[model samples]
Target: SGMLITGVTTLLLSLLVLALAWWASIRGAQMRSSLPPGPTPLGLLGNLLQLEFGGLDRALMKVAQTLSRNWGPIFTVWLGPRPAVVLCGYAALRDALVLQADTFSGRGAMPVFQRFTRGNGIVFSNGPRWRTLRNFALGTLKEFGMGTRSIEEHIMEEAACLLGEFQATNGTPLDPQRLLDNAVSNVICSAVFGKRYGYEDPEFLRLLELFNDNFRIMSSRWGEVYNIFPSLLDWLPGPHHQIFQNFEELRTFISEQIQQHQETRKFGEPHDFIDCFLDQMDKVLAPQDPESHFQEETLVMTTHNLFFGGTETTSTTLLCLTDSCPAQVQAELDAVVGRARAPCLEDRVRLPYTNAVLHEIQRFISVLPLGLPRALTRDTHLRSHFLPKGTMVIPLLVSAHRDPTQFKDPDCFNPTNFLDERGEFQSNEAFMPFAPGKRMCLGAGLARSEIFLFLTAILQKFHLLPVESPSNIDLTPQCTGLGNVPPAFQLRLMAR
Candidate 1:
């Protein structure tokens, strides 16, 4: 018993010594390189306490604002002993992301997602694997009608279904989020699975609910804690476990879809994104070839990436816009679209107010505010600070959108930010809701089409009436770490 106790004590002491060595090494790295300065970190915990106040969404933006005043737009905050160089404001973001695109193109490690993907997928991968998968996925998505009018027609069709669902609400108070999610998800389903599921399909509903629930948990404070102390949380009991369960379910669903595609696929005649990918996999595979990115696992992860990306942000943006500025948007839709036919992408040019409103909604809410973390591909100089290779970067996209120098009223929800002197739909470099540069969202075009068509179709068919007074509604998100998920509220969809 005495010898056993001695052995355990020896192991504990060794671990403590190793931890000290690691902490010392991190401090050494900070001292060796001229990293931008911020509040001093507390040993291992870092500035988690400071950045985790209220909600990470608001806290991170606030921290950047406060630090930028002293440290300029580029500054550093230690996220559990690992320092992250945050790029705040429009100029800083543009200079680094746009100017030095290649150097800052690496995908940073996000523990929450890394656990699920294991760095296998495009979203959280870097270098050759990422490049190969991303290019293939982009080409396939485009061939399957992502940016062109072919995809636009698909969005419009989904919009019609969404309108029907809203019409069936019978003008009673109802939460439109699930209906919006189904419509938005079906757009990606068309591209990936080559078929859209009905709103009442059990499998489709379960997948949507899984994505929604995972997003909610990830954006909560618990998610933030897990990211910071993953090793500790992995052993402890918590809500973070649910994120893995959700990922497993999504993986299973995607695997099933892939198997279905493999069995029924016609060679060379690609029906959809999955069919195209399978063809690529077959072409790349050889008896002697050892390395390949086009495997069944890659297909599954990429498909999930597409589905998750396509569903969440666009639907949340639509939900926020409808909940906040419904009356005014409906006014614009009525004046421009008139209730006769569905609104199309071409109509976007004529409806400057509606276009401007959509842009402003994305700006005000800043969905995925921090964006997926990026990594420095190589040691580089930025804004007079030395950022090292593999340094995690937070673009702080919310900061860019709300930069006071760029916008007239940065805080409030005003559509004029995207309008010119003549009230035309004007573009701004500062407006980077889909982010900017080499790693910009692959589904930007699809998301834009979905948001515009779905929103206009709903507005054309019915008027959005808030269950509570607009003034009483809280614009602050329910949880805000990874993504800014809006608070739950019902709306009365009165038929025009």
Candidate 2:
């Protein structure tokens, strides 16, 4: 019994000693690493308490704003023990992404991402794989009629079906979100898989709900902690487990689709994303040097990337776009675009109120609030501050969108920011919801087309009726899974 007690005591002491050594090692290196000044970290805890107040992005915005006002464009913060520089304002963001693109070449990978995606997808991979996959996906999108009439026609057909679904709601208060999600998801799914499901499709509905639930749970302190102490979470039980499981469920669905495609192999001439992937596989797999990552694994992850990244972002932005706009935007759409035309991408030029409203929603909503964390590829200087290689740099995208210096009324949901006196859509360089530079969203063009077409379609066919007084619909967004999801609200779709 005495020996047993001694062994337990020794084990505890050893763990404590190792932890101290590990922590000391981290602090000494981080302290020496050349970066701009930041708030002092509290040992292992870092400045987590400060950044995690309400939300990580919100707290980062507050920190970035305060420092940029005093510290200028470039400033640093400690996310746990890791030192992260906050690149605030549009000018600095543009410079880093556009001018100093090579310095910020790598997208920082998080522990949560590693757990969920297994480094198999385009969203996080770096170097040759990332470049190849991104190019391939972009090419695939083009082949599938991303900008052409072929793809636009598919979106138009889906939009028509979506309008019909909304009309069936019979003026009763219906959640515009689900109908909108159905429409948007169908667009991407059709583009990726070469088929679209009905609004009532159970399998498709489950996929939407999985992503929705994952998004909900991912935006909390849980996600922040996952980003930092991912190794520690493996020892303890938590929500991230379920989140990973949900992601796996999604991956499983994607894998099955790939299998179905494989059985009937016509990949050399891809009609959609999956077919394009197969074509890439055949081209890359040479007889002499046959080392290829472009296979079933890549195909599955690519589809997942397209569906997961493409769908929620497009849908959430649409939801926010509607929420931010006044009823008058819809009324104006009805007056100008009218029901007979079937709102098209080209119509945004004539639909001043609608275009302004879309831009405002993107700016205000800020889908990627903290922006994706980027890793410094090499030692670099930004605004006279030295950033060390491998340091996680949080691009203050949310802050930039609403920066007081950049926008006229930064806090308000004013669509006029994007409109001239003539009410024609005039864009500002500062307004970058899809982010900027080399790592900018690959689907930016497709998303723009989708948003323009979807909104135009709905507005043309039906008027956005608010539940009760429309005043009850919340503007406060639900921060989840690295995004700001729209609040729970319903819209009654009155047929035009």
Candidate 3:
């Protein structure tokens, strides 16, 4: 009788699994019917098995490129039961993100971050809340000297401090990750928190570690799985859980800073991002408008958005600068800027080779390769396919970077990709490291300035020497999901 009961139970479970898989397939088909054509999905797994999850970014580009050849540039891929339309190549991305900017402006639900963000912060939020926070943040950032001479001065000051730290290393082979993190983060810190932490500050180091830790976990396979199966992963044990814990700790730190700003800030004279936000809250928040978006929680999340976005990508890009200073770049820098004065933003045009090198680095690395997924604000048609409103769209950014039609050598690290015959820096429409259109990165301008200023400053003062031979240096990302994490490397800095 016990054996009979076990057999019956097993039969029922198998039947249940069959039913669920049938439902998932049928649902996926319906979703794909209205969307562009692509690979057929299997059960709840969708087209997941078809994708290489080990290195998601590269895997995505590979899979998308193949599928695009079959289904055209804009086609659907199933991420579990969820069907996402991928915008491959330069033309498709521009057609959607640039031509139909407002139509593709909605933020797609990234299950990993959506659980924590809950549609609140500037980056993750949509609709009125996003508009409100973004405008406010932009205004506040500008007021705090973003894109101004004042911000350039601030970056230069931080660069000088960075040089001092590098000098202290005394040509010893050292991984400059933390030092770079500190210097890059301090720029955002000055604007947001109104102060900068010392390189050895315990609290500051802990914060940086949390950011690093979360970024790594989020860029891992675990993060990819969590995005697809958040409900299941929530019950299971994994490193992805560390992401939420780190988020909580980061939120706690931000809350503490907000409290400090609240206590210290004087009315009508906003000092930093937090202060300006607090001032806005005072004007906007009232008893009648209880659902105002400018609340304390929003403040924490928006600040978190800026703090994390500002630090991680730029620092990772800096890490990718392991190659010895190119003779041409050094020569251009010497001829135009010279060693007496630091390279300024205006010198970007004067130092074409150096500028080309920076652009090539961003393009080759393609950090944030599969950029933040964009959602359709309304029903739209692209290239004979009709997509419904709220459809998730993955703008395969690396495809644009690697688009052969646009770049001379899409696969290799060649500064000539951005250089004209005259050796002058030329712009490519497909060169979008910050992503493009209405939903572009908030710190795009600041990031460009930081990259140029920081790199030029370092190369002007020191010759970067890799611990390993140039041919052996691995430029592949440590992880390639959320961001292209540069591999760990050490280099000696000999003062020029």
Better-scoring candidate (TM-score), 1 or 2: 1
Better of 1 and 2 by lDDT: 1
Best by lDDT: 3
- Give the Å shift of residue 14 in candidate 1: 12
Give the clashing residue pairs of candidate 1, or none: none
Error of 3 at 461 (Å): 0.5
Lowest summed lDDT window (length 10), candidate 3: 318-327
lDDT of 3: 0.88
How should the candidates be ordered by lDDT, best one leading? 3, 1, 2
User: TM-score for every candidate vs. truth?
Assistant: 0.94, 0.93, 0.97
TM-score, model 3 to reference:
0.97
What's the C-alpha lDDT at position 474 in model 2? 72
Encode model 3's per-residue lDDT on 414-466: one tens digit a residue.
Answer: 88888899988899999998889889999999999899999889888988888
Candidate 2 ranges beyond 4 A from true positions = 1-22, 25-33, 146-149, 320-327
Clashing pairs in 3: none
Write down the lDDT of every candidate, Cα atoms only: 0.84, 0.76, 0.88
